[model samples]
Target: MKVYGLTGGIGSGKSTASRMFRELGAEVLDADVIAREVVEPGTPGLAAVAERFPGVLGPDGRLDRTRLGARIFGDPAERAALNGLLHPRIRERFLEQAQALADAGVTRLLYDVPLLIESGLHETMAGVVLVWVPRDVQRERLMHRDGLDAAAAEARLAAQLPLDAKRAHAHWVVDNSGGLESTRAQVRDVWNQLRARD
Candidate 1:
């Protein structure tokens, strides 16, 4: 099985690309989904989080991601602390899932991770496919999607490496600045390329 990293900036339509890949019969492990699972209501992950950052849990005893995000958004030390608490657990789950997929004879696995480059997980993949969008487009899309003001959007983007810089690390770049049909065509082309590798 060949595992590839599928990544992009926050508003670069990475999730959309992941859905297209899933539709095309590729197995995808979404980090964000796994992240949520590791911290679900009754889990130790959630307990550790609630211990470290009190009041982050909602009335339902679920991790209030919005509150936690707001707490750590621009604070490096707080963010690092949170990452330290969750990353190891998340990595363990990722390994378990990847091994299960491999055991099941799955090929062409795509790890849909938004912070693939930042976390340096791309080094473990056969290659990386970046969903690209110009910064202006990315900012506009982010503002509209998240209902964030320009400053907030810019702050979020600043936390990650610019999409343009990440291009140097990508084996393939899927430009997502265009419309859905165009993106689908590019995604299909990339799928063909991945299939060809086999």
Candidate 2:
């Protein structure tokens, strides 16, 4: 089985690429989904988070994601603490899901991890597929997508490694600066390449 890592900066359309890959018959293990699953109301992940940051739970006893996000965004120490707690569990879940998929005879698999590069998983992948966009486009999309002002969007972008830096490390680059169909075409080309390599 060929396991590829799909990643991109926020608003660079990694999610769209993931969906296109799914349509192309690849089994995708999305880290964000697994992260949320691991931290559900009764899980140890949530318990730890609640303990670390009190008042992050809602009246229904579930993690208030917005509140927690507000508390950690741009706060390096707090953000690191949260990652220290969640990353290990998320990695474990990814391994479990990948094994199940492999057992079920899945060969072409993609791990859609937003922080693939930051988390140092790129070296572990068969190949890393980076969805690329210009910094201006990324900033525009972030503001439009998340309703953030320029300064706020810039801060979010500053949190991750620059797109140019990540591009240098990618095994495959899918340029997503154009229209949706253009991005889809790039995905199709990469899909063909991946299948051929396997």
Best lDDT among the predictions, by candidate number: 1
* Ten contiguous residues minimizing lDDT sum, candidate 1: 106-115
User: Least lDDT summed over 10 consecutive residues: which range in candidate 2?
Assistant: 189-198
| Number of backbone collisions per candidate | 0, 0
Clashing pairs in 1: none
- Over 30-118, each residue of candidate 1 has an lDDT whose tens digit, in order, gives 99999999999899999999999999999999999999999998999999999999999998998899999999988778999888998
Which segments of model 1 are wrong by more than 4 Å?
Answer: none
TM-scores for every candidate against the unseen true structure: 0.97, 0.97
**Candidate 2, 1-198: lDDT as tens digits:** 778999999999999999999898878999999999988989999999999999999999888999999999989999999999999999998899899999999887899999899889999999999999999999999999999999999999999998889987798899999999999999999999988985
